[model samples]
Target: MPSPEPDDLKRLAERIDEAERKHAQRKKPPPPTSLGIAFRFATEMVSALLVGGGLGWGIDWAFDHWSHLQTRPWGMVVMFVLGAAAGIRNVMAAAKELNAEMAAKDLEK
Candidate 1:
């Protein structure tokens, strides 16, 4: 067989490059599904709430043990409210971070 010309070789190389680009794209992983997103959001929110509530309970117990001043469940109630607020704040911050990360990844594609 006759040797291929330089022009033919160049065209072949171009075709190979294009094919490789396409192959790489196909190999890329798919984005997370709706269910996965929902699970992550739920996990983040619930974990924050639990931690906050636990802290509130701990605070109330510590105050009960103190002998200097009389106290009731008021401390527990207030701390619980504060804990809930903190949980909400944490969840919001986490959601914002996740959204930014997703945006960055999307831009990469």
Candidate 2:
């Protein structure tokens, strides 16, 4: 067979470079640490709890201020319960998100 010319070599090199780039693009990323996941979950839980408490307190105060509605302790109890539920929901959501994020991170490796 005839020797490959300079142009052929250049084209081959270009093809190799393109392949490498494509491979890199297809490569997966690394996963996150266990500690990092826990930290993120905890952070979200705390934030949610704080927000829920504030909202509940505000609602309770508003209800307490209204003369006609003020007679009801049910409002306060309901708001508190709802806030706690919301806080718990947020914590669960955060945990799920954190796990997903960590899984994605691991896949990127």
Candidate 3:
């Protein structure tokens, strides 16, 4: 078989280079979005607050009835305060997550 001509080799090289450039351009994926992060954070915070508050209320009821009648009032107050703290913590965590997500999105673009 005859060897390929220089012109044919050059054309083939150009075609290969073009293909590689196009592939590189197409392979790049879009950056992550913050909307998904925000939604997830809000969902988690709301769920945690609800579950924590319910558990706190239940424990307070049980303690008031069975375990320690003497400390019932204080226990109830403490439990309620703890529940509130948990809720506040959830909110703060969500806020932090949102801030981080926003920062990440900004950096991406």
Name the candidate that leads on lDDT. Answer: 1
Put down candidate 3 lDDT per residue, 1-67, tens digits, no spaces.
Answer: 8887999989999999999988887344454467866676667666766665666667667877787
lDDT scores of the candidates, listed in order:
0.74, 0.71, 0.69
Candidate 3 residue runs with Cα over 4 Å from true position: 1-53, 68-73
Q: Which order, best to worst by lDDT?
A: 1, 2, 3
- TM-score-best of 1 and 3: 1
Worst 10 residues of 1 by lDDT: 67-76
lDDT of 3 at 38: 67
Instruction: Please report, as a residue range, the 10-residue window in candidate 3 with the lowest summed lDDT.
Output: 25-34
lDDT (Cα) of model 2:
0.71
Q: Score every model by TM-score.
A: 0.62, 0.56, 0.48
Candidate 2: tens digits of C-alpha lDDT, residues 57-88:
67667867865466355555665567667767
lDDT of 1 at 33: 78
TM-score of 3: 0.48
Greater-lDDT candidate between 1 and 3: 1
